[model samples]
Target: MRPYWCVAVAAGVLLVSACGAAGSGAAGSGGPVKLAFVYATSSQNPFQEMAFGAKAAAADIGGVDLALSAPTGINGPQEVTQFLSTIHNSKDGVALETLTPDLFVRPLNQAADLNVPVVAVDTAPPAGTKVGLFIGNSNTELGKALGEEFVKQVPADATGEVVLGNDIPGLGLLQQRLDGMRSVIKAKRPGLTISGPFDSGSEPTSNFNNWNDIVKAHANAIAYLGVGAQDAVSLALIQKNTGRKFLAGSCDPDTSALQAVKDGYVFALASPEHWLKGYVALRLLAERAKSGKALPTGWWNTGSLVVNSANIDQIIARQHDEGSRKAAFKAETDRQLANPSGYLRPLAEAN
Candidate 1:
């Protein structure tokens, strides 16, 4: 289990690690409720941080046996199979991230039949799915936040281009991010031509290779933006190495993204709060295990952060402290649940 905090976000791996203290108690006469976390993304820094949050929740909240798993790398078919295996393998409940919507429908329906409570983490269930809850963010709003930054930087009369690097078309969640970003950029700066939501091949090397061509073509684009974590880093490297000048921004964070922001190579970084996503997902599932009640389904936006040069260092430092991270996550979840007008909403089960 990779500790998301203290390692990946801090630019290197830690010498030692801390898994949350084991939980205690029993959900019923069947003994402790078995809980599993099945994520779609690889063991990337962001996902690791997410798992760290899940571990924290497992320790802090008693009476659940928690287990976490994901594919070895960025393999969707494996993830889909593992997702199916996880829910059906006698677990009491599950927190999952779907790689694709349709592929998991039958498994989710099976889960509902088996009385397995499921809460979606990182992405929302497709329409007509019986998943318990959705703990994520409004990608469109997140894009708007970035758009506001772009508006602040661009001159009203100056016409140029803004390029978006989005990878992995299979995941609709990322697509929403791209969609939101496109809307915001279009609405804010009509003169500034927004370019391709180009295929940023998932890994940094692939992203760099793909974006390298785009950079070669658009030598004078106004700004560069990415919907993936590595895309931000790749953009920073390309701009720095090739002397291609542009304001760089991105959708998520990793050590590379943080470094780029601190060095002023990246103007802003939108954090998806993966750690909080896992924590909240597991917490909601664990709660269901004990109470025998399904989650109030609907959207529970875990939230996002737009980090700039001024706050990059501070945010990275804050992310390293597991205790502080968990405390902040708890506070955020409490806030989302308490705020009636906020993104968090309730969905009654369809009768």
Candidate 2:
């Protein structure tokens, strides 16, 4: 068994490290390489899926001790504190999701000063941050795909409103999703008017209520699209409760959202491949730690999934449990290792 110390902090942080070894030299001596994968928040679906992938990577690539954590809620300062503390402790390497890039400038630059390999996941790093690479879905493309699904479901000549809700109005990723969907709808269905990318709070109950209000107000909308994880299930719930026929689409394939797609309530789901991002981020760090390989510089597009009636069953089967999900993506991970250039792209072209 790998000798290590795993500490669980009350601040919702989990830090793991190999005992009695300098992280930089650990891999050289075949000792455990410690890593920290921190997300935006704890107990959320997307982040939990990411954690699953990170754990799988740590296990599959022996001698890797991975620690993961995030804030209990949407607290930027708390997340920053976790990031800074992890940076100070995790000497092998660190990977993180910087939703609010501003909060990470100091810690990211500090990591750079310490010669630690840093990879940003789920969000691209800001201009001044010292992130080696980014790994996540192309948010704009995901939105365009969701919009295409909406367009396919609507009538050819239908001219009506398409209501959109954003759980976090100012978030760059959500805004990009809204913009992408808007671009698609305008190009294909100019006759269809787009409504507000309203601030539907990220909290589940409020998210549902906000969508409920939007639907009740625009009962005749051609389609309702959500740019947040909660949007899929909320819109589906609203549709099922009121028997509304408005075509509904949203992002992420959470359990309820997948069921929504399978039940014919939601038109389609845009899956950002949360697990792949986590797995790839941790795997990259492990490779660098063990083999002295340089982490690729640029955006590594983990890609996305458009879950609909056609392939919902396969998606559902893979997500049944952590083991099933890891097993499902093993070949893809191998493919990534076999050809890195295929997925890695310049930072500017990440969109």
Candidate 3:
């Protein structure tokens, strides 16, 4: 989350390679379909996984040109600027993760004015925008799941405290998780106190400092809910530093975070099947562009999967052997698209 040069370096290399490899695949019939992708944290594992998945999906289709980019940290204005720049330079379609919905509308509208389709992946933009599709899990649902999981782990008759760490409160997706967890915990466990939906910043070091403060103040806190990798890493680091283990869980799957879970430092992690999301986004865009039809306007909610010790082996194996995380995403996308009524739903109706 820190302003690291690594992501820019990797992105530059990938961009060059992608541009160079352009002639190998068949370009779309009307013209080359240029798709731009923007994410939250370029260095974090989940964002990297999502990018890999997007690349794989683009490769599988073999007709579209996909360009992926992300800013170094959680600066909303900076990300919005990137989105606008992509829109200005884009020739076909655009897909982005909007950290702040309000900040995204203008650029999204600009894309719409140019007759370019826009899609939201990983996070949704503000309502009533011209966004054609959304391909990510409901953050609120993940949050409720987190609260329910925590309730199951805590002693029923005793009062306990759970800390929800927010890496960036401005991101609407993270807020949904916080809200969902609050709703479920308040309903099911009245005695449970949820404290400090604190802004941990987007950097890992900032998150560590914020978490250290929480742990110092509330030594008896039973669990930690992290909305992003920074919070997840903070919990892991805190356990290592204090030699005290708390029930720590997170909302996304990053290689480092998953490794922590495998090592027993993390209790659970939940994330939308991102590989599938990427694939679906690409497929849907292709369908719309090919058919010369405008995509639906409302949000599309792609549900998530809960990963624990039981299924960690399968996930790790899939990541290692089959393809990049993106390949797995393509397969999952195929499965879900096969039964749209069963697996896909409108965001308004999904919640």
Local distance difference test values of all predictions, in order: 0.71, 0.83, 0.69
lDDT of 1 by residue, 215-284 (tens): 7777788787887778888889987897766888887768878888888888888888788788877777
TM-score of each: 0.86, 0.93, 0.85
Name the weakest run of 10 consecutive residues (lDDT summed) in model 1. Answer: 9-18
lDDT tens per residue, model 3, 1-351: 111111224533234122223222223464545666777657666666667666655555444556677777666788877777777665567778756677877777888888777788877667667775677777889888877766777766658888778888777778888888889888887888889787766677787898888788888988878877666667887898889988898867766677777988887777656666666676566555545545555556667777778888777776673364655555557766666656556655434
Task: Kindly list the per-residue Cα lDDT of model 2 for residues 1-351, writing each as its tens digit.
Answer: 544445556557665443432233345666678788988877568888888888777766656667787887778888888878887777789889856877888878988999878899998888787686999889999999998888888777779898889988778888989899999999998889999988777868899999999888888887889988898888889887887766889988789999999999988998899999999999889878887888899999988889999999999999999889999999998898779899989987877
RMSD of candidates 1 onward, in order: 5.3, 3.0, 5.1
By lDDT, is 1 or 3 better? 1
What ranking emerges by TM-score with the best candidate at the front?
2, 1, 3
